[model samples]
Target: MSFCNPIPIRLKEARKKAKLSQKALGVRIGVDESSASPRMNQYEKGKHTPDIGTLKALADELSVPLSYFFCEDDISAELAVNLNKLSLSDKQKVLEITARLIDESKKG
Candidate 1:
């Protein structure tokens, strides 16, 4: 069976949650801001597929795991909503706590 890539959908959702314009995301990923708009539009419309490098760049720019682009269902939507609800300070706090938890787990 063939599988479809979910990167386009997840990219759009992540970009929105991050409150970034396509141009902004593109620039962050090393693409020209002007080109980023159309490219991102194509991605969201499922008309273009980004390569692994672009996917990694997008994931990094959006502060999400690369695996996030391949989530199989509406879980991405839930994550987007939850992440969007956080203030920058709250998000930083969560990241700090998560890092500490990971370190603690590793020690145990």
Candidate 2:
């Protein structure tokens, strides 16, 4: 699937995880309150894609990294969410461990 294919699925997932209704998320991301639900619904339905700037605002409001919306699978998307909770040093440690695991798997 195209990279953009994951976006609507991940957007819906993140919005749900944040416990937000479509309207609420849209409003929080600066859409007019009156039009928020319809706008967000269109996005979730993949009928319209938000621009990068709007996506960034949605990411900020939902407390997820913008990259989360582009992850190709659920595991990677979930990893991004968990990774966002780490400190800079801790994140570096995770990257090191992940790389080591990949090397070990490759060698075995």
Each model's TM-score, in the order given? 0.65, 0.92
lDDT of 2 at 92: 99
Q: On a 0 to 100 scale, what is the lDDT of residue 45 in model 1?
A: 83
Clashing pairs in 2: none
Alpha-carbon runs more than 4 Å astray in model 1: 1-4, 76-108
Cα RMSD to the true fold for all candidates:
7.3, 1.6
Candidate 1's residue-wise lDDT over 39-98, tens digit each?
A: 888888889889989988898888887777887677755665466568999989888998
What lDDT tens digits, residue by residue, belong to model 2 across residues 1-108? Answer: 544578899899989988999999998888999999999999999999899999999889989899998999889988998999999999999999999999999999
Model 1 clash number: 0
Every candidate's lDDT: 0.83, 0.92
Candidate 2, after superposition: displacement of residue 80 in Å?
0.3
